[model samples]
Target: MTSNFQAKIEGLQYDALQIRRNVWRALHGAGSGHMGGSSSAADLLAALYFHYLRQRPDEPEWPGRDRFVLSKGHANAALGAALARAGFIDDSVLDQFYAYQSSFGMHPDIKMPGVEMSTGGLGHGLSVGLGMALGARMQNLDFRTCVMLGDGELQEGSNWEGAMAAAHLRLSNLTAILDYNKVQQSGRVGEMLALEPMADKWLSFGWAVREIDGHDMGAIVEALDALPFAPDKPSMIIAHTVKGKGVGFAEDSYLWHNNLVTDEVYERALNELGAPE
Candidate 1:
């Protein structure tokens, strides 16, 4: 039997920690990656893949499986980790990050069995998620749709268009989770362009918004479980997270947003994150 929600939450938390480690390991192999955004999203990805998402990794093309759109393609490292943990692929793929012919690149590709949509361009997933939900509804299928968005990606005008469309269509079966880590490529989001009243923005855009500590397994799971948050509207989760979560040196900084990973840096990162216990 599948684990209950809370137990699944616990197990997924452990899984997420391992995912974090795997993300770094993958980057260690690649020698560099988008570690900041990737690690920031580990918990949310874990919750989605391991707990909430009705995905059978061994049978990834399962018709009734829920779909996930990783809007922030830069975070593909974390998503790949979660997919491997969920058995969608062999764990050895982590060592091939950024490899010449690897499917596991810096951005998600729909060609990957478990990856529903090819994403790297911000602001594209929400609209796609709306389409997925509407398609499920039309087919009378019970599948749900989810999309993960980056904080910096919100600045893209395309997201606003998607937001307006999703609400107007009332895609209650679709949910968007914002990995609100507050920092982006060159500097803190606030310092560059603040996304203040972020929750209210989603609410005004016609989503039932909820804010939570993104790293808290309980919070992540609970928010995901309370889907739609209303009978006739889509739901949005504003997950407050750290930029480079779980690693002391990388946490809350833009420098690590696109930095090289050296053996010494990797060692320090592992020390801060600790072993997956």
Candidate 2:
């Protein structure tokens, strides 16, 4: 890579690290939150806000801005961190996560400046994103729509319905990214409800598909850059990731999916994540 390109990657990596730190901070302040999925999604969220998605932080209502919906709304801590870091909202709002009357609750709230859809009920974001994509097409707008999905959320039959519809309509401007962290709220997704042949399933539904390491900043950027993998099909990126990625104790453990974050636990997580570069 050229020096400039390498610097860009490093910059995004720093953003991802800071996002993870802020996620822990927010959860700790709330006394409890969804750390596993939030940490797992930090890298992808960083890539989206800092690199891929197009938006004016100051003019959030810009008509040409691309739309991104966090289908796995449980990971809102990471989303909130990204939005705050990108200047869409006040950085202090991170401290208000899960606080009474705070818009930054456990799920994405549309009332929040950068949040496209109020989501938390799994299996709904994809459908909402499809509608956004269709609306863009109907209005002859160039804005693209992207939705981030959870591995466990795929089990909801509604997602597949949206997937099938997006492809049938040939909405190439639409993209769906799956954060396949494997572990969910109760147990490993494989043990609960397997989604094997994942790429093939999307391909079979007529969507273009790609798979990559969710934590690899370079890979994530490359995937986003290669949008609309097919001119006549919507694209899908299945990003394999580890639950609670930056912290050792919580990694791949379902118990940490939505557990208490005591002060000691927060300190350990921050230590493992290290100071932002």
Candidate 3:
């Protein structure tokens, strides 16, 4: 907990706030969006793009760059915000969310400079990320692959298949961050499909697992620093987060998952999140 480290965390915290603010802006511009998942992932996205991943924003196609697949692609607003803040994309793109003929949409688009995978259908990102990890190993590249998944997305069953494969293959370069926001669209995740014993589930699949408060910048950074928690196993970080984090009314509510973002709602959310620099 050195002063320098604290300062670094502080900077990330600021970026996370800005990311959240931008999430609301993007959704407001689109008149609606998946605000719950997007805001829930902002802190981790900030830490990953700004501090953890070895990526070249100016040269997104660099072969040596790490790969990040947003498995919970509904949270693309946060990813877009992070990329913009990191200089991988122009800030104006945030206003184009869901616009007709716009590359930026509700989901991640591979054509987007920094987006490694075009994903929106749940339970697919892990498998794609596993392939990237395997490909990196086959090519003798030192690059790593990380995937961010939503709590509800795990119910798809494909994620477990990929999890099993990654563990069996011993892809240490692969990491999965589960944005366990607890609530999902329509209702609380447990109400729709309970993933109780979630940590145990990943452990049983033979992956190294760590649970952390996803919104805490310092904790998030520490967890990222301890990647590949085991030598021959892919790492799984269960990031406990809140749906619609940073906004009082929306927080923990499924209604805000992808609801309409009117002008009034936008201003209220921005007030809670503060002005973005």
Candidate 4:
């Protein structure tokens, strides 16, 4: 990559680091929240909101803005952090997570300024994103739709239904990104229910597929930049990630999936993550 491109990647890396920090911060405020999936998705979320998506934070309802659906809605903490950082929402809302009547709950809320769809239930986001893509096509709009999914969430058959429909319809403007963090809430996803031959499954469904290191900023950006990997098919990116990425004690552990967050634990996590520059 050229030096300018490398600098851009470095800037996104810094944003991703800040996003991870903010995820912990938001969880700490709530006293407890879904940390594992949220932390795992930070890098890709950063790339999408900061670099790829053509969004207008100041004018969030702009009709032409690309749409993003967080199918793994349990990662709303990371999404909230990214939205806050991107100026789509106020930073102070981070502290209101899960608070009484707070919109920043465990799931994405459509009422939120930048959220494309209200989602948290597994296997629903892809379908909703597919609808958005079809709407764009039908309306002759150039907007694109992207949906983020959890590896474990694939257990729901609805995703496959949506996958088939998108491919059958040749919705190239739609992209599905799977945060394949092997481990889920209870245990390793492979142990719970293996999704081996995952890429083949998407290919079998007639979508173009790519796999990348979920935590690598450059790889995340590159994969996103090369969107709609095929002209006549939807795109799928299987991003391999660790459940609790940045913090040493939390990394790869299912127990951290939705565990309590105390003051000391929060401080320790921040210390390990260090200050984002």
lDDT of each: 0.90, 0.95, 0.95, 0.94
Q: After superposition, how far is residue 57 of candidate 2 from its true place, in Å?
A: 0.9
In candidate 3, where is summed lDDT lowest over 10 consecutive residues?
268-277
lDDT of 3 at 98: 97
TM-score of 1: 0.96
Model 2 Cα lDDT, one tens digit per residue, 12-82: 99999999999999999999999999999999999999999999999999999999999999999999999
Compose the digit string of candidate 3's lDDT tens values, residues 29-48.
99999999999999999999
Q: Give lDDT tens digits, candidate 1, residues 1-277.
A: 2468567777887898998999899888899999899999999998898778998888899999998999988999999999898889889988889999999998998888799999998778888888899999899999999999999999998898988888998889999999999999999998898889898898999989999999999888888878979988989999999988999889999999978999988888888888876
Q: For model 1, state the Cα shift of residue 137 in Å.
A: 1.4
Give the clashing residue pairs of candidate 4, or none.
none
- TM-score-best of 1 and 2: 2
Model 2: lDDT to the true structure: 0.95
Of the two candidates 1 and 4, the one with more favorable TM-score, higher being better, is 4
User: Can you write out model 4's per-residue Cα lDDT over 10-29, one digit (the tens) per residue?
Assistant: 89888888889989999999
Higher-ranked by lDDT: 1 or 4: 4
Compared with the true structure, the alpha-carbon lDDT of candidate 4 equals 0.94
